[model samples]
Target: MTRMIDIIVPVYGGYEESLRCLQSVVSNPQQTPYRLLIINDASPDPRIHEDLRQFAARHDHVELLENKENLGFVATVNRGMAFSEDNDVVLLNSDTEVANDWLDRLVAAAGRDERIGTLTPFSNNATICSFPRFCQSSAMPDQWDVASLDALFSRVNVGEVVDLPTGVGFCQYIRRVCLRETGLFDVERFGRGYGEENDFCRRAARLGWRNVLCCDVFVFHEGGVSFSHEQAERIAQSQEVLQQLHPDYHALVEKHIQQDPARLQRTRVLLEMLRTSPRKKVLHLTHHLGGGTKKHIRELSVWLTGGMDALVIRPVEGGGAMLSFGATDSAPGLFFSLPQMYPQLLELLRAAGVSRLHFHHTLGLETCLWGLPHDLQLPFDVTLHDYYFINAHPSQTDTKGRYTPDLDAQSSSYPLTVSLEEWQDNQRQLLQKAQRVIAPSAWAVREFQRYYPGLNYLVAWHPDSEKQMPWPAVENPYRGERPLRVLVLGALSPEKGADILESVAVAAHKESAPLEFHLLGYAYRPLADAVIEHGAYSEADLPRHLQELQPDLVWFTAQWPETYSYTLSEMLLAGLPIVAPDIGAFPERVRHRPLTWIEPWDSSPEQWLRWFREIRDFLAQQNRHARPWQDQPVPRGAEGFYRDSYLSEMESAGEKELPAVDDAWLGSLLLQSRQAEGRQGRLSRKERLLMHLLMLRQGRVGRLVSRLVPVNVQRKLKRKLSRKPIHELHRK
Candidate 1:
């Protein structure tokens, strides 16, 4: 059926915005026949009157109406809606710009179902209907113009509509039949606008009508144009009335936000934008457990800023993967179930403009990722951040948590469904397909090559600093009578030598040695009270903490061979005197420095304490501010690798032969895997409790708890909440 929409644009003030709105409407005519009925509601600004008159006179289909007295927004829109009897009416704000048959798209969306009482288009400032961010005003994406973006939206989200509690009045399409049933806006309650549309939507909903967001249309809203001065006052009054009339309104909206049914649609448009852009994008695949690998990807993304875009894929805990976009750590990510959506995942990546793949680590990811490059036919690169590629043990450690040269000796000790040989073979196959393989250090290159034997490797150190200042040796921090302060850095898991840390602290206390220990990062479990645990610290916060601690020496008790230590890089940059395990890249990176000691990898607590005492005596003999500064050439780190190899133009994996797997068979495998993993169905009771606590942290109860409890107590509680049970850790 043919539809005619009366586009009722109520003009109050803001002549520039009003003119742009009318001009855009004129430039982009709707495919569906529509009459532009512009109503001037006694605009305070006289300039809008003559402009509207001339605008109407120039166009044959334009109809202009004016009120003698100012009737306000709620009354003005109602007057216009009543102006057209049979046809549908669109209450368009005069501060908005429409493009590319926007009205036609709205009408088409309304035609999808008779029960759809009203529809709103996506806008830059339309609250819940806003793009990029919901319930917040955002500027139109800089790369796109209105017409182009509108066209893209129309192409990508055709026939898509997300249900909303209310249709935003900025660009609302109200059906005439629904309007007749629901009646007009309550002008008495909402005099100058605000919650009037929400009230109407609620009334319509009560009458079994739906309010929806038309995903295919794009409109630019220059908000606060009309009723700018009276906004705060009117909004408060409208909200009060809404609460009294529709008590469930706020709850419904909040529920919608929590559910976020429109996230996929928004992500689709965002990905489509990236897909069409000329800039090359690289997708980095890593594990969910953050460490140096996650840091490397984040730094890589920042380094690729303006040169290329970076996307990261990390496995979810149970059985999915999360894809985080752009350079910022806080940038939004999407999570999807794996195996089941394996084929669709490839298609989505293709749509997201992922031209190249960079595997940082894939330990916890699903089996599908092992064959990703071959399945998707995308050329890739690899970075060896750990020994996960060659052994089940990430640190290449024995059962006793010490470096082991014989990789196969403790194979059975590491729990896994597959044999260590099978695991290594899978990783080997995955690595053999890479276009290039990179390691952060020469030591890492040597270790990885011992397993693979023939694959060529590139050495690129992880980027540490943008400003390479000289390594300035600090003054001796030890004063005559005080116990020497020893500091440790990074997360202290078992392989990281948390046990060694605990033993050393205990030994010092027992022997009454003049030694004090402080930890900058957390341990897998709580340590001795004597070892001051400062908990987790960010790279940015490290310098400030170091200055305050004024440690005599920094110690690393790592029990295994590390591929590359970012913490070591930080300590080196700080120029502090150090003691580290003899194994791993520590000797390779820091052996040549003076005032540095590399201890045996399996050093006893008493031996570590003796070294600390010797260091204290050595510092006591030196001058208060003694050592000189010297400059050294900085290595080409991860940033350099990104700049050299990844910044270059790349080809997309176009039209690859996707794997054809039987759905029923694949589903059976996935179900069996879930059942075996004991992760089938919804969240467990404990998980639900955790989720409830998280919710409370954002609600009134959270606020009350914050006020009633001491900050220190709160911090302790937070630490407890984030830590896994000791039994769970032991099980692993």
Candidate 2:
């Protein structure tokens, strides 16, 4: 048969404190099969007995023990212990609160050794087991939450147990074998309170039983609540009685404390370990674990695992999964309503001791930055991948693929259903709520500042840029080349200057220029016959390809202001000459590198040909001698930069309180943006009318209209008709 444990709380006065103790026990019940016995020691207040009776009536495991007359605390606890004949007993004061898993941890530690007689856990004011100091009164720090502290204790001391000369009685657990061997507390000598537990522990220790302190558990004690007025007198009398019973008690305790001055040091070390554990729990909320953003997040997550416990929370097919690094478990339907989700999320965060949250992208996910509750008090930051927050079209380009300088203007070319004003408002709300904002380049920071000024931001390069590349100083890579090979990397879309590549390839082939163009990305359009296509390559495959193909020059032909170019950084690291457009971060990245040429954004095809010719000439001239690449100090890698930024934020998070964000205004803006994105790709009334008219004139009428109208005149009419009011187009 499994032996049950009994927890005996000896109540004196202070009905409110006693009630709180009982309520804490009831709320967080022990996992082990245990019974609670509340002994009312004939308190002056009648309400204390009444409350205990009502509580015991409601709980089957709880029993009320009423004394006909007032019997002090020691006798009351002794009487309650007699009721548990074959079970282990726990002496708990009525003015203390128990945390979850408190009993299980303590009992488990005691059961580890058969000779373990008494076990006690650390408490706020327990004499020997008091945290940070022995026999000193202290309270839990305000910065430490109950749940976080409980988690910290579990993490810091997994199986640590220490031997002590005496056990504090505020909350002590005594083994059944120890009680049977050493007998109960000496209530006759120490009648009132205070030194009974110490006397009992000393007796047990003499009988070859160990009194251990379970450092992994913490219980809150409201010290002296029951005996506040008479504690001094009671303590003095108990000491006198204890000295008479055991003459060498005080000397033995003093010798034990003096022998290990590190006892206090050990306690402090353990507490500090719990307080500053390197295992910072972080939850990364993103869309999917793929693409450039996902790759960046994965690198950052791996780096964080050096001193943190990182987890990724992303939406799966149907629901989502709270996955550790490289774990496979699809938790379906984890997110629901806000009220239902907050508690579940909070519980998970508390259990994991998550202190920081990072949001990357939330395109497909229902819950976004605006949905997060502010009361959680978790410090969070957002990474801006693109201008998605400022505009529905992330590129902020017009219909003809040109950058739009004015943020407030409505574009007729790429008409997203959302207005510029609404987009700006939503962006403002998100930026204001975030504790920090991270961008990849200075251009992105400047762009964001244009909308929301005076906001502090962090510029973190891609983590891949931090890799070390040995300079090819000894060997000239362009030796005996039949023609200077030029490589264009990245997706070959129009935004990446696919047209420019085609024009350059055709122009070079027609003019018989001494340059060979090789394309190493997804070819979106049919390339010119002269250009060689290598198809698409993964990030890992790119280095091998670059080594094998040893292109003399690389072109960064991006049309958009490239936020940050990973390809350009890689080429520069390899000491290869590069020809890139003078836009975005290209000029800033390739600043001091020799054999580099930059073309204007609006440069013509002939101008690109001219730059290529100049680069080829420069490479030929350098091939005469072994041109040692110009050595410059390497920039700080992404891992170090991100780690420093993260640690700085974490260290400062506790010192200052984040200003409260206006959730109502933010929520409205988010709702409006969501509604706009949902309605995207739907045709407007003018588009529908034009489609109908074109379909109606597909036969003889279309032919006659086409013949009668001049081409330029017809194009002017269509352009004028397409530019209509945005609000009117959205009307039902």
TM per candidate: 0.66, 0.49
Error of 1 at 178 (Å): 11
lDDT score, candidate 1: 0.77
Model 2: residues with Cα > 4 Å off, grouped in runs: 1-278, 315-343, 367-369, 373-375, 400-402, 407-415, 466-476, 479-481, 624-640, 651-732
Model 1 lDDT-worst window of ten? 722-731
Q: What is the lDDT of residue 467 in candidate 2?
A: 43
Once fitted onto the true fold, the runs of candidate 1 whose alpha carbons sit more than 4 angstroms away are 1-151, 154-161, 167-211, 214-247, 254-264, 317-340, 351-353, 409-413, 416-420, 464-482, 538-552, 570-577, 590-597, 620-639, 652-681, 684-732
lDDT digits (tens) for residues 421-457 of candidate 2: 8766866776777787888777788887877886657
Kindly provide the TM-score of model 1 when superposed on the true structure, using C-alpha atoms.
0.66
Top of the candidates by TM-score: 1
In the range 1-732, model 1's lDDT, one tens digit per residue, is 686789999888888999999888888866788889998989888798898999999999899999999898889898888987898999889999998888888888999999999999998888888886667787776457888888989987898998999888888999999999999999998877899999999999999999999999989998988779888888788888889999999899998976666666666677676766666678888876677888888777666555556778877656777667653445556555777667656766655657788899877788887677876667888999988787666787665556777656434234455776887788888788787888877778888877887775787766554323455664566675799999998888677898899899988999899989999898755577879989888889989999888887899889888877888878877878888888777886664476778889797888888878888888887777656544433444544555676556477333232233343443343344334334433454555565566557667668566456543354345434533332333233
